[model samples]
Target: MMKLSLGPILWFWDKCTVFDFYARAAEWPIDTVYLGETVCSRRRELKPDDWFALARDLKSCGKKVVLSSLTLIESEADLRGLRRICEQDDFLVEVNDQSALQLVTAREIPFVTGPAMNTYNAATLKVLAGKGLQGWCLPVELSRHTLARLIQELEAEGLDLPAEVFSWGFLPLAWSSRCFTARHYNLPKDNCEFRCLQHPDGLSLRSRESQELFRLNGTSTLSGSRYDLLRQLPAMADMGVSTVRLSPELQGMEAVVQRFDTARRGKVPAFDPLALTEAPPCNGYWYGEPGMDRVARTNAD
Candidate 1:
């Protein structure tokens, strides 16, 4: 069975909301939960101690908790934070940056690579597997065929790292040093006032034709369409995906978890649905098409 995972919260929420959200999640059917600040370092709604506390609580509930590192580390403060996560042996750390990878691998800390890591082939997976890699998430842009090929190659070489797919979220397209959210508000990067808190779901960018194009949250830009793979779970299961990750949203998360849980348990076809009821659902990257394009599920939905 392909286990369901809740990716770290991508949107900025109040500290109470984050705690309350996880408190509720402790009872959800999710098998794995990733905790951390993956975007801008300025948003300090939760400190390192806070993340550790939450990880302990979640672990007590029988959930596998993994601390995730920042995608774009820019300073010594960020490096120190990554060291804290890598040095700890209590939970697995998700490496999203090259610096984190180097630090963790050099220390022989067993970790997993996130979608942001530049792991596109079995050769990269092989190298990381030797460096204490417990698992890895495929880069979001790779297609089902690509994953199938990589899996086939890995198994042929007898290097079977657990495979995870970014099954649902606003596809994180890229990262930049200058926060786009701050730019949206015409505020400089340093004094941006943590304005990402205003847009919990991210600031949506649309083309002049009113087509949803992208979303800006802190230093990252995501696709405007929420990439959904509920209907494609059966196919992924057949392809031997070990896990499916759903990025956290402020609202409707419980229902989203429940829906994926139900579908994964039965290996059944599911109607593609959006949790927050805004952007149209997309699965184009999974089908080797432009990520923004919505590819209909041939078998269902």
Candidate 2:
């Protein structure tokens, strides 16, 4: 069976809700759980110590916990946090930036490269693997044909790092120093008072025709259409993707997991996973099509 991984929480929830969510997730049948702040560092609902504690607790519950770092590094303070996470020995670290790759290299630590890291070719994969990269999250924009080539190239070189795909969730396409959520509320980035915590998922962006286009988080912009790959589980497994990642959201996540789990096991889910979300569903990047195109599953029965 293909493994399931819970990606890091991208939204800023209250401290209590964050804790309670993970407490429940620890009992899920997932193989790996990624924890930490992968977005703006100022969304400090959970401190480093708190994340480490949660990582430890999840590890105790028989789940593998991987610590994630920030996607954008604008300040020395963010660098300090990256250093702290890379230096830790208790859990594995997922390097989200080039600077993080440097730190992990210096420490001689094996790390997973987060999707935010730009890795598109076999040469880049080989370079990262040389620097202690044990696994990598495929860049969200790359198509399956490109990935097939890279995997084949790696296999030709006898390289054995695992390939994990971002199977479901809104695609986080870009990040910036300026917080869009703060700007949306007519607030300055510094004095914004953590306004992003107000939206559990993210503030949605609509087109001129009032159709949903994208979602605005603190510094990141995501696709309005949720990425759904339950129907593609067989193809992903055939591609030798060892793990499938589910990015955390506010609602119906347990059912989401169950749906993917059932689908991966060749059982039809009670509900259509694609229709469960308010936004339109997409699996284009997986098939090398436009990122927003909905490709119906030919194998779905």
Candidate 3:
């Protein structure tokens, strides 16, 4: 059976809210849960010790927990934090950047590569696998065809690494040193007052015509439209995908998990356009088309 895993919370929430969210998530159908602050290091609602405690609680509930490292490591503090995460022995760590990977490899720890890592080809996968990469979350920009071909190439090389796909949620497009959310409030990045907490889903960036283009979440930019691959579960299963990742949102996440749970159980979920919040659904990247295009799903493809 294909497993469902919840990605780390990308938005900044109150410490209590974060714990409450995970407390509820413990009972969900998810097989795995990723915990950590993957965005800005400053969004420290839950500290490293707090995250470890949460991971222990989730593991007690029978959910495999993975700690994710920061996507961008800018300062010595960030590297120190990454080292701490890499040094942990209780849970598998998701390496989001090359620095994190280096730290994990140096410790000879088996790690999972997050989507932000530049793992485009089989050669890269093979290299990482040699260094104890247990699983990989496919980069968001890659298409289904690309994934299928890469799997074939890996097979030919006698390399087998579990592939995990980002099945749902807003695609994290990029990260920057400048915080757009802070800029919106006319504050500097150093002393931005953690304004991202105001918009739980990150501040929406729309065009002059009011077309939603992107979401400004601290130092990260995400797709305006939520990426939904509910209809592609069957295809993913056929491709031998070990896990399907569902990025956490502020609301309706339980319903989203239930829907995905149903779909993976051999039921074709009714495609409700409003199942996700904010902008419309998009799966074009799966079909090698524009990221925003909502291409109809067909088995023929």
What's the best-to-worst order under TM-score?
3, 1, 2
Best by TM-score: 3
> What would the TM-score be for candidate 2 when compared with the true structure?
0.96
Error (Å) of candidate 3 at residue 50 is 0.3
Cα RMSD to native, each candidate? 1.5, 1.7, 1.0
- Cα lDDT of all candidates, in order? 0.90, 0.88, 0.91
lDDT of 2 by residue, 85-106 (tens): 9999989999999888889999
The clash count for each model shown is 0, 0, 0
Worst 10 residues of 1 by lDDT: 266-275
| Residues 121-190 of candidate 3: C-alpha lDDT, one tens digit per residue | 9999999898999999999999999999888898899887989999899999999998999999999999
Specify the poorest-scoring 10-residue window by lDDT in model 3: 268-277
lDDT of 2 at 48: 92
Query: Model 1 over residues 150-268: C-alpha lDDT tens digits?
Result: 98999999986989999988989899998999888899999999898889999999999999999999899999999988888888888889999999898898888888988898745
Q: How does each model score on TM-score?
A: 0.97, 0.96, 0.98
* Winner by lDDT between candidate 3 and candidate 1: 3
lDDT at residue 119 of model 1 (Cα atoms): 91
lDDT of 3 at 21: 95
Clash pairs, model 3 backbone: none
